[model samples]
Target: MIKQPSIVIIDYGVGNTQSVANAIKFLGYKNVKISCDFNDIENADALILPGVGAFEEAIQNIKKRNLVEILNYQVLDLKKPILGICVGMQLLATYSEENGKHEGLNWIKGEVKKLNLSREFSVPHVGWNDVIIKSKDPLFTKNTDLSNFYFDHSFYFDCYDEQNVIAYCDYDIKVTAAVQKGNIFGVQFHPEKSHNNGLKMFRDFINSIS
Candidate 1:
């Protein structure tokens, strides 16, 4: 049998862990491991940081598990591809002003801020919103339709380098929906819960590992 891609679904004690793993599995990436162990993550072909909840707490948990250095080593030093989803994506930036100012992984040049929008759209920006594709990349294609995925967040990434922004969504304002900087990637939307469209994204990410 052809060997499937190996993806490590990082278990930082937050977010939709199993579902993300399940989604990858559904995409034929059977060699999926959900773990906080440095060795497991370090050895994986690609990493998936699936996170939900507050920014500070998530960073605290990642630090508590001693995953910071290993993650940096693997993703930065080793140049392994990593995908951060939702709050996980926010954590990839330098800082986030969710509850208060909190330090992020600094993997990408960006900051997280609450959705500053007019009364036309709600706070969370819940449900399905169109993804305005900004760039053509292997991870997020250029031909992708705007209304392709699901979103559930109040805060979003404000990138310093506009060139890194792969796509975005509008909710009275242009919100950062996805970011791609070299080997690092982040999605403000939840692909795991986005049905078939999400599955296709999963396939793209996993297939790009080799």
Candidate 2:
């Protein structure tokens, strides 16, 4: 039998960590570990970075736990697949303008900026919105499956490469909702809170080995 991949949720102590772990468990992943240990993270089958807070605080917590170098080495050097969720996704960018300028993990070529929607919409585009799929990815087999998902953020990703944007959501203007760059992947929406749509995406992350 093929061995189950050991997925580790990088817990830097700043968000809904358990919900992601619980979601993975609900998906029937038996080897999921929520830890910050270098070995655990470095040796895992896949790494998940889940967060829900300020960009500065999130990066600070990850630094406080000494996960920067380990993540860089494992994810960049070793080329292990890494997935970032919500604020966790923003943390993967080059920098963020949330509360002053803060550097991020710099995994993807992007920057985090506050929502600048027109009068037609409001900031923190919360609620279920359409996730328009731009390209065919491992998670999305059909465009119909990329319907509505939950979102609760004021800032969105401004990807340097338009091709990197796998899926997006419309909020008066096009907003970066999901991004994929080689072994690195990020989702601006909350998959754990998105019910089945979220669960389906989570499985794509867990099983996405490259």
Candidate 3:
């Protein structure tokens, strides 16, 4: 039997951990678990932060779970492979203005803000959109030519390092779709909900560590 990589999907009472777990399992990874323990976050090979909800509440949950410090050590200090999806991606940034104003994990220098469309566009951008890959990252390998992936969100990350932006999808304005700085990575879209291409993307993410 293949020695499956061990991955931890953090659950702090936020969004779908099962779906993310299911995606990793779909990738043929055998040893995947949902961890509420902060120590599990520290000990895991890779970490996935998946969230759906307001910024403040999510941050509060992270803090309340006592996972902030260990996650910082694992992600920032250890430089382990880390992936954040949707609001989980936003949490990696410096700050957010979603519900009032709040601070993020600051692992990456960026801010999360509500999507300001041209009035005609919808507030929450849902469905499929083509993502333009800006850099040659392993996660987006041959992703530009493939069909569009799934997306559903109101806020996006405003990153300081433009070079870290690996991909972008057209919304109200062209926003940061995927950001990668060293071992830390974040995606605004949900690869699990994005069909086959997304499954490939998730599989790539699972096997990204070199």
Candidate 4:
């Protein structure tokens, strides 16, 4: 089993796992598994962290599962491509201001702050939006036409390494829609909900390890 390549979706019970799994399957990936088991991390070739809800709750779940250290070690030391979606993306940073002050994975240098746009924009920033590809990365080899994708989040990260940002979207100012630093990747949008473009992105991510 160690020799087999599997895409493990870290099951912290925060995000839309079924949708993400379906997306991976739509991309022609057959070995996708959702697991909270620590051994699953070692056995898999790639990881996807899909999240939703409050930052504090999610952090507590990760900590309770004793997965914080493993996730950091895997992405930072193992040099594996770990993709985080939505609130999952926010968790890759050092801190978040969703409720009170909360610590995160700290794999990327940044803080998650609430959206402070004009009154015209909604608070959550839901629905379809464009993902403006900003940098060159294998995960985004599809194209760079400012592709439209689904986005639903109230908080976002202020990345320390701007170069790692592969895409951006408008909410009030330009918020990072996607990030890729070495092997760690993250997205603020729900790729599983973005239709064809999202499928392509997921496929590219799976192919990154292959």
Candidate 5:
């Protein structure tokens, strides 16, 4: 029998790690864990970085846990598949302009900037929005219902290279909903909270790793 890949949800003290874990477990993936320990991260076959806060705070929390080096080794050096959610997605950028200029993981070439929408559209960009698939990436292949992913964010990833963007949504202006660079992937929406549509996305992510 084939062994199930161990999936580690990096707990950097910035996201709903438990919720993400529950979702993964619900999908029947038994070898899932939430940890910040270097060994757990290094030994995992895949990683999930979930966040629900400011870019600066998230990055700082990750630094405090001494995860930068290990994460770099696993992601950049080993090329393990990773998925970043919401603010977690923003952390993969080159930098962010939220509050003040802050550096990110630089995994993908981009910057995080506030949604520059007019007064009518709101800033946080909460609730369900339709996703327009831009690339034929494997992570989005199984699902066709891309219209109702939950999103709660004030900022969005502004990828410098257009080729890296896999999907997008409209929030007054074009908001980047998803991105991918080699094995690195990110989504501005909260798939764990997005119900069935979100669950399918998790399944897709797991299948990609398999």
Candidate 6:
């Protein structure tokens, strides 16, 4: 039997690390852990950067923990696949306009900006919404329904290059739902909260890692 890869949920003093870990555990992947230690992060087969907070706060925490360099090395140099969720996904952009101009990991070429919508639409685009898949990325399979992924955020990733965006959600304006750049990947929605579709995403991500 092929051994399952060791997946690490990065705990950089921010994000819904526990909930993400729980979701992964629920999928029966026993070789998983939540840690901020550089050694553990470096040793993991794949990484999950999950967040549920302000963009500035998340980036600050990541830098405070001194994770920026290590993460860059792992994902960029080693080509290890990493998934950034919500604000975690926003962290992948070049910078964010939240609170102030803050620097991000810049793993994907993009900028984070607040949603510009009319009074009819809400600020934080909460609840379930469907995504329009733009690519044949393995994370989002064909058979799986592309609707009803949980989303809760006011800011969205604005890709500098449209090719980086794999999926989009229409909310007055086109909101980037998912992005992929070689081994790096990110999702604006929380798959952990999206029921079976979410679980399938986690499963697909795990399977995609070689």
Residue pairs whose backbone atoms clash in candidate 4: none
- The backbone clash count of each candidate, in order, is 1, 0, 0, 0, 0, 0
Candidate 4, residues 9-110, lDDT tens digits: the string is: 999978898899988887767888999898989878999999988999998999998998888788888887799999898899989988899999888889
Clashing pairs in 3: none
Error of model 4, residue 36, in angstroms: 1.0
TM-score of 1: 0.96
Q: TM-score for every candidate vs. truth?
A: 0.96, 0.95, 0.95, 0.95, 0.97, 0.97
Best by lDDT: 5
Encode model 5's per-residue lDDT on 111-192: one tens digit a residue.
Answer: 8998888889987898999888877457777667355699999999999999998999978888999999999999999999
Winner of 3 and 5 under TM-score: 5
- Model 6 backbone overlap count: 0
lDDT of 2 by residue, 44-128 (tens): 9888889997899999998998889999999899889888899999998999999899999888888999998788787778999
Q: Give the lDDT of residue 94 in candidate 3.
A: 95
lDDT of all predictions, in order shown? 0.87, 0.86, 0.85, 0.86, 0.91, 0.90
**C-alpha lDDT (0 to 100) for residue 125 of candidate 5:** 90
Model 4 poorest 10 in a row by lDDT: 136-145
| Position 41, candidate 3: lDDT | 71
The digit string of per-residue lDDT tens for model 3 on 1-210 reads 556677899999998799988887877787888988866776688989998888899999999988888887887788889899999999999999987889999988988988988988898988888888877457877465535888888899999888778888877698788889899988988888987878878877876765
Model 3 residue 207 lDDT score: 67
